[model samples]
Target: MHDKTAAPENQHLSHRTAWLRAAVLGANDGLISTASLVVGVISAGGDAVLAGIAGVVGGAMSMAAGEYVSVSSQADTEKADIELERQHLANNPEYEVEELAQIYRERGLTQELSHQVAEQLMAHDALAAHTRDELGITDQLQARPTLAALSSFFAFLFGAVWPLLAAWLNVTFLFPHPLITIAVGTAIMLILLGGLAAKMGGASVTHGAIRVCLWGLLAMLATALTGRLFALVVG
Candidate 1:
């Protein structure tokens, strides 16, 4: 028996897939980019405080703008596709129903049962049935430009805090050059962030943590080398 009901809120766990991807990518960008900026600027004998501030603020804004534009474009495309689907259903509904049933059949339903399910579901909500079965789209999968933008912006801001604060504290209070401590802090934070995100997404925690940390190490190394080149040039 079909449940004949929707949970309203948790109807689709697939909805979180895009959000998780965007957020994890955004926050990792924020943390790594800002941290790299901090390390580079300080290594080049510049003001760490000012550099950290610039990285956090500038990187956050950039993340927000990029996410908004990219996700908005995707949303626009999906909207257009949905509109086209709606037209097809209106103009050639019988064909659409067959298409829906065929989709179910391809998913392992018997031909007769597939038709019955399609017919029943179409009777309940024709457009929804076609969209879900034929087009593989749903309300849960619809993109939200505003939500993507905000999540990216805030996630980046949150991730940037680790390296920025570590470098600043070491410089002002503990050490003359904070590169070692900054590296240590950044490595730990990246591991934690990746592990937590992977855990939430039911992915391998070790793999995620190692991947992010390795990339982070590379980014920082490249930026630090750039700082060295700049310092030599200035000299």
Candidate 2:
């Protein structure tokens, strides 16, 4: 027996998936990329705070622009698809209706029942019914270019702040060296960011945190090695 009294919460998770993905990905990129840049510069015997600042600002702006362009392109494609669907409905409504009803039938409704359901839905909102069922597009999940871009921009900025601040703190002064401090701070941010992202996505926090931290470790290590190599060449 289904408890109709239960709240239909989180139904919009799929709708939110787009923005959530953009935000989390942008922030994660910002954190890892900037932190790596700072560590790389330091390993190469450059100033830590200066390099970190440059990396943070550059990374944030780059992330914002990239997110804007990407989301805008997506929005354009979705808009074109919707327009085409509209035209198809105008030109071949009966065929479209049959298509929609068949989709419902395939979902286990009786043929007559499918037809009735489609008929009623189409009569009430033909375009909506067709777009949602046939094209798998819903108003709730419609692409919002501006929203995505803005979200990414700010999230990236937020992520970039952690590493930049950590680098500025000269935590290595308290530790063995700058590398240790920077790496430790970055690692903490990575794990925290990963867990936060996972929680938002309703996934396993440990898995998410571990996965992201591992990647961060590899990224930092690679940067450290590259910086050391470059330093030797320059030295």
Candidate 3:
């Protein structure tokens, strides 16, 4: 009797690279940008809630649009490569087979085995085998523009909402030093977001947290100075 137990599937992070990148970038930018906007407005003695609201909305839309356009471009390139490969396979079947076999040879397979494997694979599905092996295109890593755009939009909105909420709470309770509260809250969120991103990417959580915090601090500082200068110039 043959054992029919299923093999365990490996969970590789490469498959998540496309969407993960968009989500992380969107969230990080939204948090820092919105927080910076609120900080700058507060530093200029303006209404924090109003600035936070505007920044959150505008930032989320911008992130979504940017992600969609960029990912669409990547998808286009992939499509073009696939079409070109199809043409090559149609034009010269023998050369394409040799090319695929050469790829296998370079990857450590013996010449005899490589050619055999290539021939068998081509017989089964020539385009798929070539696209995957020669062109490095796989269904797992295909770029989906709509998915990326939605991920970015939601992530940005989620990140921006935190700072907005923090500002609103500060104002509602009449905090004497609202800037401190907003800044601290934003920094905490940034650290947490960084850790979460790093965890998903299989990297050091502490390093990611520290790195994002530093950048967030610098962005807020720059914006605060700009607001101060603007206030000084106008008022």
Candidate 4:
């Protein structure tokens, strides 16, 4: 008697995991880069408001271009791979079936059952069966160029807004020396972003926060030194 109720547990879950990884990575990049940019600009003696606005605009455009190009390239490669797999399947169905059966056998299935499972899956949906079992490709996480680009761009811009707003508020009314205030605000914000990212990624929150703060400080220091050196030379 065939065990009709038995369903493969690992396959579908793996697809979800892949998509989560991509999304989390995208969001993390957005936060770190935007924060660093804003900090650098503020440290270079730019007015806090101007620095904030520039960071928002620059981060958004950079994210969009970067994400679009990267994900588009990945999507193209995936398309090519799929096309190749399709052609291979068409040209050599028997060999393809055997290959899938072999994969199942390698995964601890007996030869007879593996053959039966592969044949049954192929009969229902040859392309899907090959995509999953042979190519390890899943529909859920199939790269969408536009979606990835838009999400990255907007998330970066949104993430940048916090530090920008802190700078603006500090400069406008709260602080006599806006640079110091902005620096402090930005450091705190970086720590928060890092902690959030670490939590989501299942990492050490303190370590991530400290790492981000250190990088932001280094970038800001470099920019500040450059600005001072330029001023000295010009004067």
Best-fitting candidate, measured by lDDT? 3
Q: Kindly list the per-residue Cα lDDT of model 2 for residues 15-64, writing each as its tens digit.
A: 45656765776889888988888888878988878888778778777777
Candidate 4, residues 1-235: lDDT per residue as tens digits? 8787888653453433544444544544544555455555555555556756766787778878888898899889888988998898899999988988999999999999999988999889888888877777788757788987787776676666766776667766776765565567767777876776666566788998898778776766676676566556654
**Which runs in model 1 stand beyond 4 Å of their true positions?**
1-21
The local distance difference test score of model 3 is 0.88
Off by over 4 Å in 3: 1-18
lDDT of 1 by residue, 33-85 (tens): 98898889877988877889888998998888987899789888877877898
Pairs of residues at least 3 apart in sequence or in different chains that clash in candidate 2: none
Between candidates 3 and 4, name the one with more favorable lDDT.
3
State candidate 4's TM-score: 0.81
lDDT of 3 by residue, 1-235 (tens): 7556864565676556646755776788889999899989988889989989988888888888988899899999999999999999999999998999999999999999999999999999999998899989898778898887888889999889987888898889988887788789989999998988887887899999999999998988998998899899998
TM-score preference between candidates 2 and 3, better one: 3
Model 1 has an lDDT value of 0.84
For model 2, state the Cα shift of residue 204 in Å: 2.7
Clashing pairs in 1: none
TM-score of 1: 0.86
Which model scores highest in TM-score?
A: 3
How far is 209's C-alpha from truth in model 3 (Å)? 1.2
Residue 167, candidate 4: C-alpha displacement in angstroms: 3.0
